[model samples]
Target: MFSEDPGARIEEVFRRIQEERMAGLPFINPALSVAAVGFARHGADWRGVLLTPWGIQLLLLPAVADWPVPPLLTRAFRQYPAGTFAFLPNHEKELGDYLACPLISDMHPFADQQTALATARACLIALDIPPVRSEAQPAAPASDGRRRFLGLDG
Candidate 1:
């Protein structure tokens, strides 16, 4: 059962997790709060970054109600415009079945929430950009006489 406001639902779920399970953890950043960043419909799912006290993650929730749930702890690969990413299937009673790909597993390095949010946004933008592919090209003969004299020509 996907909520009408998935971002708010996600925040609520994590905030509760933080209170019940993650309190007093050394890796939890005090400056960060549970937030869903840049959530929008991507293909058949809602894709976004989720910032929590413990880490930042890229989450994919079903846009439609009939989405099938994968077995818990199973790994799933999702194709974005940029590349393929491996996600772990998870289910929350509040958010239902979703896929999570951890972008940052440690929140200790983030000095403030703003920085973490910015990084999350950047990750979302990066997912839409195709990776650059490098191709090998034959080297051209050195045109400069100085290069030939110095034996620098390839």
Candidate 2:
């Protein structure tokens, strides 16, 4: 299934691996990140912003079980639209949260075009900083619904 969307393809590969290792097939949950994001410590941040009705369903459904994301991005997906979002992990981890960073083109450690494209397509709802030309843009409708969170808890 590896096609032009190498990143997406790779994500699928890793997901299958995870599913196999879990002793059973993967459930229908579009878990948007790595095994760590699913972990109790990171799941909340990863599931932060993009918790829409459809987004929620995609994430929790077995048909769309797609995650395997980068750790730094765990914060970015906090607000992206779940259905339209994608979190791409660099094949190389030494690069770390660097992102080859779309906004900072020259700042890349390794090219890894596929991974770069994947990073570009991640679930970023918004950012205090933007990616490179690439061109600056934002999703049409917010992943969030009626109201936004002020981060205050009762």
User: Each prediction's TM-score against the native?
Assistant: 0.82, 0.21
lDDT of 1 by residue, 38-58 (tens): 888876688899999898889
What's the CA error at residue 18 for candidate 1, in Å?
Answer: 0.9
Pairs of residues clashing in candidate 1: none
lDDT leader: 1
Runs in model 2 deviating more than 4 A are: 1-3, 25-74, 77-154
lDDT of each: 0.78, 0.28
- Give the top-scoring candidate (TM-score): 1
